[model samples]
Target: MDTFVWRDDYSVGYTPIDEQHQELFKRINAFGNALWEGQGKELLAAHLRFLADYVVSHFQTEEGLMTTHKFPLYEVHKPVHDAFVQEVSSVLNRIADAGLDTATAILVFEKSCDWTRAHVRGMDQELGRFLGAQRNSTAA
Candidate 1:
């Protein structure tokens, strides 16, 4: 599997969010490397646990920012975060049930990372635009 790389286009125009996304990319890439080297079975569960926790924290940060700024679509955007948390929680549950299998590792990465990539480009970018405009407007 190719390492997940952060591209310039993924920038949400927010430093905190962008930095967090880069950290996510690093974690995913690390997991991918461990999986490809056949060490995933031992570390997959731990890696996933850490990833899940970090994701929740990151989501909370985004939500808090949106709420603080009074982002118009915060209500709509929050559910996406809720859904993603549920999805990742389910994956964690599966790992707890069946243990770390290569198939699960591969599948999880493809789905989770793909969703994250699309999210940055979609909803997050929109949020970025709003927040950036808010900052600029207030600065003037």
Candidate 2:
């Protein structure tokens, strides 16, 4: 499995958001590591729960900032967040409820990592650019 590493380019121009993103990666990486180590359900579940819960909190922070700043693309962007939350929530729930076999565990890690990389590179980078432009304009 490809590990999630925080890259300098991943910064979204905001310190808090960037920090949270790094933390998100950290949590995901921990989850992957636990799974790879063949850790038992309790350990894996703890990491998965952390990922799910942190993601929800992080989304709230981003959405709040977008709303406060009146980000032009917020309406378009928010649904992405909602969908991700639902997806991750379902994965976490499935693990919690029915327990995950080896295959399912790997699937969860792959899905989380793939989605995160794409979203950060695409929609999130756009938001970061918008925020940066807004800052520059206000400074001028």
Candidate 3:
């Protein structure tokens, strides 16, 4: 699997959330690189641990903001986050049980990267627009 690259086009124009998303991409990419480089199982496991923690925290932050703003799509958007966490947990469990193999782990990691990009583009961008418009309306 190729490394996931962060592109400016993914920005949602919300500084805090955008920064968090960038950090997420960086961590995930680092994990992928480490996996590809044939890092030791212990090291790769550590990276995956961090990734899992960060993903949960980041999604919660975004969800909290959406709830606070009463974003119309919050209900729809939340299930995506829940589903992602479940999927990541399942992968983590498998790795724990079956032992981490570079090929298998890398494939799952790449799928996650793709999911992140698509989610940011599809759901996150829309949420960002909604939040931004709300801010502008309040300011006016």
Alpha-carbon error at 97 in model 2, in Å? 3.1
lDDT of 1 by residue, 57-131 (tens): 999999999999999999999999999999989888877856679988999888878999999999999999999
- Give a tens-digit lDDT track for model 3, residues 1-140: 53787788899878888999989998898889888789977777778878889999999999999989999998899999999899888878877855667777777787878899999998999998998999999999
lDDT of each: 0.87, 0.85, 0.87
| Residue 20 C-alpha lDDT in model 3 | 96
User: What digit string (tens of lDDT, one per residue) describes model 2 on residues 16-98?
Assistant: 78888899999899899999889887778888888888999988998898998899999999999999888877777777766
Candidate 3: what lDDT? 0.87
Candidate 3 local lDDT, residue 108 = 70
My TM-score estimates for the predictions, one after another, are 0.94, 0.92, 0.93
lDDT of 1: 0.87
Give the range of the ten consecutive residues with the poorest summed lDDT in model 1.
33-42
Off by over 4 Å in 2: none
The root-mean-square deviation over C-alpha atoms between each candidate and the true structure, in angstroms, is 1.4, 1.7, 1.8
Clashing pairs in 3: none
